[model samples]
Target: MRALRYLALAGLLATAGIAVAAPATYQLDPTHTMVLFSWNHFGFSNPSADLNNVQGTLVYDEKDPSKSSVDVTLPLSGLDTFVPKLDEHLKSADFLDATKYPNITFKSTKVSAAGKGKLKVTGDLTVHGVTKPVTLDVTVNKVGDHPMLKVPAVGFDATATLKRSDFGVGAYVPNVSDEIKVRITTEGHAEKK
Candidate 1:
């Protein structure tokens, strides 16, 4: 009886260990995820646009953050500049050419901890049919059960700067500013097991 009890205890401990080390998968909440981009417009003003309805999945490993990964899709149809004419122009052949490349995507190649609650995520960003490696500075906003939904959730904010010329979107170059600043905020909910 003593030997049997010891074996059972060992099995239970091993099971607990595996559970703690496993990564959790979260589906990004479209309503809570948004991407914002800004750039200098003709040196006259800084204009910004917002893209919504983002879809993505995040596999987060709390024990080993390096094992985590991210994949997201941003639809150009959701892009809004607030001004109707400007929005149309941006989507036309002169700029993004939305009809040809309707969606932008990012797939993480590596994830590393930067500091406490921060990370350096390097990924491939595809824009205008060109793919470029980009690194984003990410801050973990929260990682726990959401108050409103009462479900396991994670939130993060990330920022990056990229040159439009690199992605074949350099229509105005120095005039409209080749560099673009991008900010992303996302909340993801874990599917109930």
Candidate 2:
């Protein structure tokens, strides 16, 4: 009877341990993570800008994807339009007002599996001091060991659309097109234990 009771207690403890397993944490690889955005320019061309060196943390739960979360920071200083003059203009008081609000950030509120290797991530995106809820259609590019780095890594491609007016960044609304198409690609490596 004593041995049976001990076995039962051990089994209960094991079950509890499995139920409480924590999600894996990954650190975003700054060099490989970037945001690209484009807007129509005077109905002639679609000009784009790239924001590089994104820093973030991702808590991923493979067993239950809904438990995942993401938090990222994008520095306005990293904004590059390829044209030096445009870069300065974008960071000036007219557009992003980088001097006043230096960083753009996003924090995930919910994560849900959309389909096989896809997810819908809803989060609060803060830009130009305005916070708004935005949803990203995310595709899981790969989740596995890195070939060169030899560490567990994950990759994702996400897209979203927003209006510049919503974030108080509208300068040339109808002319430049207020709607902005945003694409993000990121690679993250597992945090060292």
Candidate 3:
């Protein structure tokens, strides 16, 4: 009886030690992550801007994609329209009001595999002091070790269309266009620990 108990205890310990690993968490590589936005300008053209200095964490599960989650934050200070004056104007109270509300954030509530290498991510997006539900069509680019860093990494491209008026940034409305298209290309490095 004593020997049997010892064997059972050892087996339990071994099973516990080899338990399935949870989702891997990765730190967003700010230098490799960019957010681009475009909107119609008075029916004349579709002006575009890029947001830099994005920071976030992505928890990915290969076997079970539904277990994945993502949280990202983009600093309004990183707004860049190439034109300095336009960049400043975008950060002003008339637009994003970067001085008061400095960050735009998104936190995933649900993640589901849409098709091969594609995902439907539904989340809450907070911008300019307002929070609204948003969904992104995400496509996985690659997932493996980085050649330079020699560390685990993942890359994806995602897009979403939102109305600026929904976030209360409707400065020009129908003229400047209420609809905005956002694109994101991001790379994440696996977090050690």
Candidate 4:
């Protein structure tokens, strides 16, 4: 009957619509994620720093940048200035205050295409128990099924700068660094249901 045929056609159309409208989700792999930074020391030399406790999720719209978003967290206790003593000092109240705020987090409120494969990720950077607005310059490095996990994932390179003093980290002013540089290379792996 024509009624049955119409029902079948409607079902097919609904399935196609769902496929076309579904949003893409990419998960971040903590092992593959890296965050780095460097700051000037007394306006004479620059010292490098890296943090290794990055973990989070990234839901990206491959076909539409407007639908993309990111959530990331970097543990402050993992601060590495390449020196144990300096690292301990960094965790102190004068710096990160890891005891009070163990994590530095980024939760994107908006994402816009920066043209090419780059995107502008605007979010809150919470550090040392203080929160501030920060923007990251990001580039999608890769997107595909992860080889080891067999899950949909996205990789990105992100960079941002912050005024350390603004976060209440004003211990060594005029001698240490004023601006803090943060660089991130991350992979988001989709979570399994």
Separately for all candidates shown, the number of backbone clashes (residues 3 or more apart, or on different chains) is 0, 0, 0, 7
Clashes of 1: 0
What lDDT does model 4 reach?
0.82
- For model 3, residues 70-106, the per-residue Cα lDDT tens digits are 9999999889999999999999999999999999999
Flag the better candidate by TM-score, 2 or 3.
Answer: 2
Per residue, candidate 2 scores C-alpha lDDT tens digits across 1-193 of: 9999999999999888675656878999989987999999999999999998788999888778899999999999999999999999999999999999999999999999999999999999999999999999999999889988888899999999999999999898899999999999999999554
lDDT of 1 by residue, 121-143 (tens): 99999999999999999999989
What TM-score would each prediction reach against the true structure? Answer: 0.91, 0.93, 0.91, 0.87
**Error of model 1, residue 179, in angstroms:** 0.5
lDDT of 3 at 12: 94
The candidate that achieves the highest TM-score relative to the unseen native structure: 2
Which 10 consecutive residues of model 1 have the lowest summed lDDT?
14-23
Model 4 CA lDDT for position 119: 92
TM-score of 2: 0.93
lDDT of each: 0.92, 0.93, 0.94, 0.82
The sequence of per-residue lDDT tens digits that candidate 4 reaches over residues 1-193 is 9999999999999888565644567656667777888888888888887888777777788788778777878898668888899898888877788898899888888889898899998988787877888999998888788788777777889898889889888888868888888888887777766
Q: Over 4 Å off in model 2, which ranges?
A: 1-4, 10-21
Where is model 3 more than 4 Å wrong at Cα? 1-19
The TM-score of predicted model 4 comes to 0.87
On TM-score, the stronger of 1 and 4 is 1
